[model samples]
Target: MNAGEEPGVVAMDVESTHMPTNSEEFVDAPNFDLETYISRYEGFSKIQRLQYIARRCPRLKNDAYRLAIKDLKEGCNTASYKEIMATVGDSLGPGYGYDAAWCEAEDRKAAAARERLELELNQFKTNLIKESIRMGYHELGRHHAARGDLAAAFKCFVRTRDYCTTGRHSAE
Candidate 1:
């Protein structure tokens, strides 16, 4: 209904609107004010500055985000740590609280990468060792047979048999 239209008379210009049925359709409104916070404690120490940022921006308090910020600052410490800190704070602003989530995700990703690399390395080592054992067995068998010692050749061939077995569950 139009705000000033009569109860019995519908306004031809009034448009009917449907309310949103899902929360996902709603946009999050920006609620944090970074400039005001910076102005309030520009004279504070480094830790104090971080604490204020953490309080003002809940994302900054997240372990991942804080660690990322710290890492970034340390990387630039050789030049000027304070400048790096200021830049990170300015860049993050109200987004600081989610920093920990981002950092945690990154850490998880890195750990997975390292695990994959180690697995590949271990596989490579296993293959190399297996090949070496096979070669050694063949060489020993050939040497014994060349000396006309059939009994010794048979023993060497048997010892080399264990190396051909596959799988981690196979005998060492």
Candidate 2:
């Protein structure tokens, strides 16, 4: 920078969140005394202050602080301050920063569990078909056939055929 150039108007790259100055940047704080609280923890990093406030005064730990602390930590320009504030604030039941990503991850786990259960059920049904046929339980095969499950009856017939040829059950 030139000697006569203004300090505040220094040319910056497109990726700067905070100014390269010693002064702390100011942001709007509604519904709380955020500025004074910031000054109280002026020497602390935004993350540190948030941790302290969350531990000491959870009632006073508002959304604004969470957003600022997250912004300081992540350094991504994806979310507006208010959007971040609402996400950090509105999450309930317990704990901190239960954002969209966390919820989506949980949903994925539940879906996977459901899929596994379905697979286990199908395998159990296949085993039952094989067992009923091997035991000469024609009534169970006839019941399945009456239910319009020809595919299951065919599976049972195939098992019976194999058992007759090999002289051993499919389970063996």
Q: Which candidate achieves the best lDDT against the true structure?
A: 2
Write model 1 residue lDDT over 1-172, tens digit each, in one string. 6687778985553355566575423222256444454444321134346554554555434432354445433221212233334545645455342244444554565456445644653564577776556546555555444333457657756765566756532342
Question: Each candidate: what lDDT?
Answer: 0.47, 0.48
Candidate 2 segments exceeding 4 Å error: 1-32, 39-44, 69-97, 100-172
67-114 in candidate 2: lDDT tens per residue?
A: 454543343222233344464565533434535664455446545644
- List TM-scores for all candidates, in order: 0.24, 0.23
Residue runs of model 1 more than 4 Å from their true location after superposition: 1-87, 90-98, 129-172
Backbone clashes in model 1, listed as residue pairs: 58-97, 59-96, 59-97, 59-98, 60-96, 60-97, 64-100, 65-99, 65-100
Give the distance in Å from residue 57's predicted Cα in candidate 2 to where it truly belongs.
Answer: 1.0
